[model samples]
Target: MSDATLAIEPSGPKPKPIFSRRNIIVYGSLIVICLYYLVPLYVMVVTSLKGMPEIRLGNIFSPPLEITFQPWVKAWAEACTGLNCDGLSRGFWNSVRILIPSVIVSIIIASVNGYALANWRFKGANIFFTILIFGSFIPYQVMLYPIVIILREIGLYGSLTGLVIVHTIFGMPILTLLFRNYFTSVPEELFKAARIDGAGFWGIYFRIMLPMSLPIFVVAMILQVTGIWNDFLFGVVYTKPDTYPMTVQLNNIVNSVQGVKEYNVNMAATIITGLVPLTVYFISGKLFVRGIAAGAVKG
Candidate 1:
């Protein structure tokens, strides 16, 4: 055989360079996006540290001459929401009250639904999943009115239970999709082996699936915590003023147009409201990345 023919005989076309100009363009765009996203956070930090006098000087980029924790203290203990002088501390607790049970219930329901859809060939499963996937695409605002009426009819309106249920209902479609995709990525043979070993559905799920799903669970937790913590509209509309989440109180403080706007306190309250989700993101960011990567590969 000729050398040229022999050389060309087999393995398909050679691959292109990994670090081509297109790759550089993509990475450069990402860096720009990351900086764009982080700029607000930088502003918030600087603003939070500054006093009202410095803030009015209108140099948003400048550092504070006298950095003080006074704003933070005020935001934590004494910032006003309407006539109420109590700061965001009360709202923070209200958020926790709504967040914990909502996260737990949502995750449990999503996981079970995901497992069932992935493993079982029950009737109408595909139709149900399609509806769920479609449901995720609908804007949540479109459902708010109906949900409000339903909650009122059920006598859960203006209560923590109402807010928790709202979060779970709104969160379910995405969470179910995440877990279902993750479960689909898992090995079918493992499930079959468990079945052959006389394991029942719940037995196999709890024994084999749930443990394997911890990374995805962590991812789910991160998503739900951030969403629930930062929630403002639902908190305002569904909850009583006394039960408002920190975001609502923060908004009221920042947007109150009548009084002398204490920019420092506004910034402080904004940061305080954001701190929980920010902390969760910072602490679990690595785990979040790992979990998402693992889940994506399997999904």
Candidate 2:
């Protein structure tokens, strides 16, 4: 036999180079996009650290020559948002009050709705789900006045409770959709076994579904928290100044026409306002990705 006939060839295709054209294009685009977002954030951080004199030097990209945390302190405690000399502290607490109840109530209700829709067949389930799908796409502008009147009639207008209700309602369509899709992806055998064990609705949910639904729940929590925390139009229209949310207060602080604009304080307050959602995303980022992938696969 010839020498070539005795040798074995590799079974699979050869590996591509690490720096292939496709890799270069994808990675280069990603790097550029990262810089696009990260540069502004870098400027905001550096500007927040520098004093007014250094800021006026017109070098926004430059790191602070003399770093000071006074801007953060002022933004937290002393910056005048309006008639009130107090800074973001009031708005921060108000946002928390608004955030917690909104997240809890919305998640609970939406998860239940999703589970029922996915697992429990009913006469009008299709119709109800269709309505919810439409509701998700309805422009908030169209519903604004109607919601205001509804809140006013219920004596919840201009209150945190009213705002909470608004958040919960608006959050419903999307969250319910997310949970429903995720629950639908769950193994039918497990659900059937739970039923065979004489498990009721609540029993199955609490014992079987809830234990496996952590990723979706985290996804829901992060979405609700971000939406409720960053809401401005609702916060402005539904509540008075005393109960204004952090976003509203941030707007007031940034737009105040009363004095020289403190760029440092504005930047500091902006970062502080964004911290919660950013923190939540970073902490549960993996879960969020997993939940999205799981929920999207089946639905």
Maximum-TM-score candidate: 2
After TM-score superposition, the amount by which residue 131's alpha carbon in candidate 2 deviates from its true location, in angstroms, is 0.9
What is the per-residue lDDT of model 2 for residues 88-177, given as tens digits with 9 covering 90 to 100?
A: 999999999999999999999999999999998788999999999999999999999999999999999999999999999999999999
lDDT of each: 0.88, 0.94
Candidate 1 vs. true structure, TM-score: 0.86
Model 1 Cα displacement at 101 (Å)? 0.8
Worst ten in a row by lDDT for model 1: 1-10
**Count of steric clashes across candidates, in order:** 1, 0
Residue 278 shift from truth in candidate 2, angstroms: 0.4
Model 2, position 125, has a per-residue lDDT of: 96
